[model samples]
Target: MMTPATIDPLHTPLCDLLGCEVPVLLAGMGGVARWELAAAVAEAGGYATLGMVREDPALIESEVTALRAATDRPFAVNLIPSATDPALLEAQIRCCLDLGIGAFSFFWDVMPEVIARVKQAGCLVLHQVGTRQAAAEAEQAGVDVLIVQGVEAGGHVHGREAGLDLAVGVHAVSRLPVVIAGGISTGDDLAAALRAGLDGVQCGTAFLATGESFAHDYHKTRVTAATGDDTVLTDVFVLNWPKGAAVRVIGNSVTDALDGRLFGHDPATLPRDAIAWDGDAPRLRFSTDSPLRTTTGDMEAMALFAGQGAGRINDIPPAGVRLRDMAEAARRILAQG
Candidate 1:
């Protein structure tokens, strides 16, 4: 239940458009975001996004059903146009539409074919970009919303500039509603972005430590313990996945073992599902990655992607609790201004 103290119910143009009380959205973190996490955020009045990095047609259909069963609030999902088979992607989109999902976000190219399809089904399309040029292109490509990513983000980041710079540059050229991503963690962060003229903010690392998040306990602790400078962007972990994709993560044994040897390596050489230890917990093979709710092991050495603002994290609370607090606080700050 929403209380006066926790739910601010502040309205914005984007909020009006999405029918949400808060002007924040959860980043569709690949392998990390799932039904429970998405449900909690949506229940808290923020947009919840399910990541599609581990998705297949069947999986997406089932997951969409699961998410809808949990919440009547609006929800969204991520799509990587180049990551999967074309036939499978089309099927997944059709399934989502049939199951009542009305929004889709793409990582690149503004996703035209999908934009046309989803629009026919009465869905909203959001496209993310790291540059002003791409923002213009996405707007021209007919994306309903523009999410500008900055370099401070964790995981597969694409921004060449910081949040303010990217948002400013993109906003200067495009009239689309802009959602700034990367390095956002607090009410003040969202407030600052809104004050600077961005419509909303999408966050990845901030939700990692939430109780509904699938990240391992170790992953959450490491994020809270980390400083802003502790994160580094590298393609060492990309291996067989997205070749040379730069992911931001805190350094540990696995990262240190690689030590600048980033490219031209076969990830198959690494132990496929190898079992290692972070202390007493059993960690899996250092090869590929996914954040399982049942996560255990030397998870710090695994692919625990996080942004520079991880330094701001200090607790693992429910998504609704954390998001409500952030929304209320941001509304207060924005009201002050």
Candidate 2:
């Protein structure tokens, strides 16, 4: 068991429940939140989550192994059930359970059976919800925690409400501990969330700009240079995901070209032109694939996911260092009150 250091003014029930010293959580950004970043956040006394959406079982096992090797601290593996095929989701969960992963974080839709299955195997479940209905359902499905994601969140957004309002609404109705997501990039954001009675804050665009993140350097640079106005929530990048799934990304050529026609488009009918590549696999235009460290070819045209918080992040520091700095800053702010 990793003993958490006493972090004054920042520690909350979430810290104790997740076995971390701080209430900050690294958002499980698919492709971005790999083993290295997750391990760094966990080692830095913040809860970490490895994004394993629609991944092969072998890859999941390898990433989990790498994380465990890096630190004994508890972490969760994030999975999106609504996006993943049922069979693949089952395989992913089984692989995680077999690897003895202690916790699981889910997003998009609530799958009661999946939650119950992981709970049966003695793993904690954290579900990110965008609406009060989803939060209530997740609580009823036995999730240990709720992540209320506001529409301001980057990548795939499930709710239309703002982060704080959604979190407060969920907290009022649900018995589960709640963490707020979306547009949370700074220490002030973290402090405000806690002060608003939310348990913690989960950050994506902030952490995506960190050194350990698997996002391409271009993506990190774009995020660091961007302002809140630079991000646009659109359904333009819809391939591989269900129709109507909107994602917030840095505005680029693709978004510019499809400005007037961002929604109600069918992914199946879209041209399969290879705008980028990850190894030998061709990434199609309008696909949900973002620029990862291994991605190449017209990187700017790819989905550059960032939240409004992208404006707040100015540097690409080490993941552990950035997380600690955020926690310390939040502590200082909280102490003033």
Judged by lDDT, which candidate is best?
A: 2
TM-scores of all candidate predictions against the true structure: 0.88, 0.97
The lDDT for every candidate, in the order shown, is 0.78, 0.91
Per-residue C-alpha lDDT of model 1 across residues 20-138, encoded as one tens digit per residue? 77888989987668888899999998888898764776778777778889998887788877655678777777777777777888885556676788878888888888878778878
**Model 2 lDDT, residue 237, Cα:** 91
Q: Could you tell me the lDDT of residue 241 within candidate 2?
A: 94
Q: How well is each residue in 1-337 modelled by candidate 2, as lDDT tens digits? A: 4444444778789999999988888898889999999999999998999999888999999998999899999999999998999899889988888888889999988989889999999999999999999999999999999999999999999999999998998898878899999999888999999999999999888889989999999999999999989999898799999888999999999989985677787887878899889999999899999999999899999999999888889999998888888888888888888
Identify the candidate with maximal TM-score.
2
Q: Model 1 misses residue 54 by how many Å?
A: 3.7
Q: Indicate the TM-score of model 2.
A: 0.97
Cα-based lDDT at residue 253, candidate 2: 94
